[model samples]
Target: MRILHKQQHLPPLDGPRLEPHPFRAAGMPPDKSNGAPLVPVNRREHGLEARRTDMAADQRGEGAAVNTEHKDGDRQPPHGAHDAFDFRQLGKEDFEQFEALLRYAFQVSSSEMARIGWSDREMKLSKKPIFEASHVMGWFYKGRLASQVVIYPMEVNVQGEICKMGGITGVATYPEYTGRGLIHSLLAKSLEYMRDQQQIISYLCPYSIPLYRKHGWEIVSDKMTFAIKDTQLPARHPVEGQIERVDIESEDLHKVYKYFALQEHGALIRGALEWEEYWRWDSDDVMAAVYYSVDRKPLGYVIYYIENEVFSIKEMVYLNQEAKYGIWNYISAHFSMITKVEGANYTGEAMAFQLEDSEIDETIQPYGMARIVDVQRFMEFYPFQFSDPRLTLDFEVKDPIAPWNNGIFHVSWQDGEAVCEQVATCHSGHRIALDIQTLTTMLMGYKRPTYLYNNDRIDMDYHLLKTLEALIPPDKPYFSDYF
Candidate 1:
């Protein structure tokens, strides 16, 4: 894998200093001379404090200057040297090396990369935009890139409110750096950055669930994939909309997608970049069709492709029942050319009931995991439906990874709104007790509080649990984007 470094004015390593041994406690700064702890700084706050600290150390003859090493080869530091590597944001000039590393880590062959329009030359010159420089964090050891992580700025529909979310992807570490805990340090730094940016939640498609679970991420949604023979497809039903074949790049597709995302819980509010990624098809056989009404207003769309008589539906989105039925009728019209159909649904239910045969093969798989980056901030914006009168809830939340959330929280609701605040004192009895993971899933509507209580995942009074359940609306979480 290639490694490139060209940007000037790299940020100072004001984050927690690394110890000689691997796997040191994250976010724990080195002890000061007076045996006092140093205050941690967010990304923005780091600049002033780092400069002041550097100047003070230089005056003391300590010579604590920012390392500015840039070379193409590995250069080992002297024994016992603490500042041996540089960590900074990578830019477009570094895409060559970045793509090479991604290819190796993701096992993308040259042909496969070319098939996805990621050829080295195309990626370097297209300028359509691959990723933002600030979003890519690189850990350079001895002038060679050894580890990296990408955080995609995104937003999700939490209940009916739009909440800022950070989607993490492209996390990779070279084999030689596997045991150094570089990933942990990077993640800690990323979390602090997210908190500063007001991003209260994070989501990731895990390579290993257990690995990410240790970092406070838990499963939040599931996807069901179905395979049905042509004979099993439901007969076409009359609807107000008429299906019309359209180009994949039609603007009407996004119109339908936006309407669907706003109405669906846990769906991502995609931006232009994410939309491009979602519509990027590798094969030329992909086709699109829109369900339109008599007035020519689009309400739904479907993207699919056929291969060897097997029809594959890449995506299906609709805004109403008529649009949904119209799209299904469009798909059924292809029964003459295709023998089977395959598609995915995130509602956790098989589409077999809608088919002529209810025995169609279907598989349910966990989709993605999410974590509450800042519990207090998330709860402040959470939409809680308050019933007549008023309700108050006391929560004793336990978060081992994020200490800011490990405390007693008092939440009061009135007039369809809630006010949450962290309390100094604890309340005995009559309080819901749950860890961060359980709290995350419960608030996301993945699991009801009563279910968690019955399953021994939480401790709470039955009546109080029922009240908590009533405050949270029932929602079937659905997330379509991969990253």
Candidate 2:
């Protein structure tokens, strides 16, 4: 096939993975085909939103240390109750208790919790021991673990800027404590702790999107799923390459990934420590495959396995067209045993457009979300290049998740570089006001300020929308790893 460009030595772990878990699937609206539905905003007179209430109350009963003091009024805790609950970071000693809390809170089994860790045993975990204590925090009521959340520090690449992020997970609360707002209390404290630990951004796989949204998190990225029809495969590239199997324990793949992460935005830095944590899972269901130049230089790798007549492509990465085709040819050559190739696909290019047939079922949905905890710091560190001079745009950021982020920012640039300053008003200049969620959406390329304005998610004039769009750099931000 014709080559657009010949790039070699691509990294591993650059591609996407298999179908997400059912719980993950549940997060997406029922109509994934239509993007997010336009649900009505609650009227003040409509009383309370039941869904939010149920979700907020979901973590109540377990020995959670929920702060219930009134902001104004008597010094007593809410509901005339003041009981003692223990709070501490979980460890090996509390694995069973932690598992029990998760199962009871979420209706998941202890084994399922382990499986979520990519483990088989009930108490065994796949994470690094260094994070074991702080990653898992629990609330104990009367010596019983009631509520817990795992917070792990992650190094993520955001638009070429490597950043320290806190990934929140394993959120569980006992059912008996419903309506006590314990989870909210836990979340508030946990976020405070994250800030103290120098985590500039936080990520999570939310159980309830609305619940998290109430806490100021927004949907930023999405996972795209595709069914690769046999006929849709592209013609093999002209360059010759060889395919080989290698042990996951080898560092060859990790080295290639390191090179790949730097060239791409939104990739995770899988340092030596994190790499070990990633491969502890069983690859038994998947094949161990890699592609290299005929001269023996590694260029690509694939982790996949076939089961139930489906050749599931868990994850694959190729540095160039040759490596991509070489690896695909290996899988297709085994077509006798494979009926279909389905997986997450991202090559910084459109795969369907490259396919022999464009008409196929390819589903793309948002996967992750982020909010600018510190707008000025976020913009100062942001790498933006403007081709025009005299470009300045002001933004009114409404970050419900954190008070520090809610305000106006005057962003300006000179000599193609950019900076931001907090301002009281735009002073008749271009202006845009959007909630943090819409801002995240705009940042991720899912929606633009104009679209958000049209949908009333953002308030902006036509000129302001143009200015806003211009201020946002052109490149689409993507995350290379799932939390």
Candidate of highest TM-score: 1
Off by over 4 Å in 2: 1-83, 86-96, 103-136, 276-283, 346-350, 387-389, 414-417
Which runs of model 1 end up more than 4 angstroms from their true locations?
1-83, 114-118, 123-128, 387-390, 414-416
Per-residue C-alpha lDDT of model 1 across residues 1-483, encoded as one tens digit per residue: 101111122344222121222321122221223222223323121112343344344323321101111111122223443266688887776666676676666665667656766765664443236465238887888777777878888888887567778888777766655544556556666777778777888888776665565456778898888898898888888987689888877888777777677667788987777776665534667889998887777888888888899888877877667788899888888889999999878765568777668999999888888888888777767766553333456787765346787788887655544567899765534477776777888899888876777666676545455456656767768887774
**Local distance difference test scores for all models:** 0.68, 0.59
Give one digit per residue, the lDDT tens place, for model 2 in 1-483. Answer: 111111232343444222222321111112323223233334111212353344345423222222121111111136634256677777787877775564455554546545545433523353435346346776677888766777777766665556667777667666554445556556666677766665666776555565666566677665666787676665666667788878776566765566566545556678765665455444445566778788776777887777777777766776666777888888787677766778876433356786778876788765666655566656555555343345566777765436667789887765555567888878636576666666666764556556666666766544344445544544455554544
lDDT agreement of model 2 with the native = 0.59
The weakest ten consecutive residues by lDDT in model 1 span: 63-72
Q: Highest lDDT: give the candidate number.
A: 1
